[model samples]
Target: MSADAFIAAGPRPPRAGAVATTATYAWRGLLKVRHVPEQLIDVTIGPILLLVMFTYVFGGAISGTTGDYLQFLLPGILVMGVLLTSVASGVILQADRAAGVVDRFRSLPSWRAAPLVGAVVADSVRYLATAAVILVTGLLLGFDAGGGLLGVLAAALLVTVFAFALSWLFTTLGLVVRGASAVQGIGMMAIFLLVFVSNVFVDPATLPAAVAAFVDVNPVSHLVTAVRTLLAGDPAGADVALALAEAAAVTAVFAPLTARLYGRP
Candidate 1:
């Protein structure tokens, strides 16, 4: 047969399947976490060190009372913990790309969105683990969750959801970038800017007027405030809603973009 006839005679690749593909990718991601358990060390240790150092060293200087400081600082650390943990999503994506795991998956007859969606879902476990470490450490340091167990759990779930949304954004960045190292650098820079520029360690009003304005509007600040309010049993109607809205908006915007980019060479 002629080349054209041979091309026409062959079957076309299968259309993307949704449920099975997403589940398979999600399982693969969970397996990766199991194999690389050491990755949890940073998440666990970082919060502890930050809590110890800030409460002992800078706590008195900043808040004049370590007890009050722990309450204030722990919430910011919780936000930071989740944000920092989300950076791993980008690194893992870059690694998968470099190792050709993504290419191997792409060659299969599965859903195009599976790998992207599954990665985010799997990484959520890590977010939950990190948040737990932060909370336990905060409790040891005399931080109270006046909002009670349910509220604390709700705050944690909120952070996990936010982290999942962040994973989508970073995954897209990893797909667009050439190397894992470059992606790591970019991810670190973004996290630092988000954490440091917000009301993480100090009140935004204490910062310069321009800086304060930016921090007030920063989504991280709102998230931190919301978590703190929940923990303190304070009303968090608008702030919690805003944080959820932001996470939803981010996921809605980036999840499809990452899937499209992942499907491409």
Candidate 2:
């Protein structure tokens, strides 16, 4: 059926109808993934390459042995995978906006929040796929999760939740940016800054005292630390709390901002 027929603009839709509208838009996003499997390249290839190259190539240099490094690096790689995929939500939204897809949806009588919400929700699918690739690659590379299966799964879910929250930040950036390429560039720069400056690749204490303080405060570092702590079967303690707080703060700030900006004429 045609989009017009699928979403006939008439009376204002009931509030409850928002669920159906959001689901439809979410399905549309998923269909795009199905048709353009090329879109999966970043999520699939990036994690594998990072996991392999980092664990084998740089791992020994950084940690004195490949085996010890793999254990430490796998958790960070999982977080890296999730962080990298968070940009998908914004890039997709920007493309849709540039193509007038969002404009067309705005004309419908559906829920105002449906388009943004659905697009970000669809990105959670990408986040999950990347997380899986990282997990499997880490395992094959002899990275054992000290916390076992349950710990690994829990860590994946936590990273996905954090990624879901960060998606709103990038989605807002997409709305602010002019083009899809610019959105992707800006998103990557932000991710790069967060990851490199964090404890993802190195021990924060090994850095200068000033840089180390920032690493201690960086939300990404907190997240990686949480994953490490969980996988080690140790108490996550403050790292988990800090990571979750950061996620909540990011979502709270950006969700409203993205919704407002996207709703603007």
Candidate 3:
């Protein structure tokens, strides 16, 4: 056939196998990570610096006891670390979409879920690293996990699941937003609002009545409290379950929204 005839023919159909798509996306994500080792540094170093600064600078004023303060602050830091790492999802998604990577993926004969699933799976490494650094920093600052090793592991897993859910929310935002800068600004604002308004630095009771009421119901506060209770060997009350449920609900709401947005022309 002439070159023109060959060019006129359509491209081969994409393979629709689930396992193949998963593996392809997984490997692609891993390869991207290998090329960008510096990404890991944020996960590791950010937590360390935050933990140290918070414990040393404000520990006395906050808790009147550094040890107890570390115990309380470390869990908040863990949640913050995971949330911080989640911002990268938006950043990366924005970059990919801007650079036409998502378009290229759409052109390919791959599973629709591959890109999203792969991104979340790969980003879990960052979440894990951040969690580990927070735990280590807590240890160095004399914070102990009163619930023992299993409790610590469970808390880490909880944080990871939360981070994964957050990734979906941010990914949708990134994909739908006009540009990366907008995504970053919005994500940062959201993070700051969630973290600061929660019972992260101060006891919610000490706040103004209106602020206290809002903070008491903030999901981030519930997550931080849950992590604190788990670390301090206290009861895992309804708060923890509530936080997990909220995170799950967020994932459910955003996952389909993202999928629909991503699938659109």
**Candidate 2 vs 3: which has more lDDT:** 2
Error of 3 at 19 (Å): 3.5
Q: Candidate 2: deviation at residue 56, Å?
A: 1.4
Model with the higher lDDT, candidate 1 or 3: 1
TM-score for candidate 2, residues paired by index: 0.93
lDDT of 2 at 146: 84
Which is better, 1 or 2, measured by lDDT? Answer: 2
Please provide TM-scores, in order, for all candidate models, with all chains considered together. 0.91, 0.93, 0.91
- Candidate 1 Cα errors over 4 Å, as ranges: 1-17
Best by TM-score: 2
Query: What residue pairs are clashing in model 1?
Result: none
lDDT of 2 at 71: 88
Model 3, span 162-241: residue lDDT tens:
88898899999998898888998999899889999999888888899989988988888988988888777778967679
Q: Each prediction's Cα lDDT score?
A: 0.88, 0.89, 0.85
> Quick one: ranking by lDDT, best first?
2, 1, 3
Error of 3 at 64 (Å): 1.7
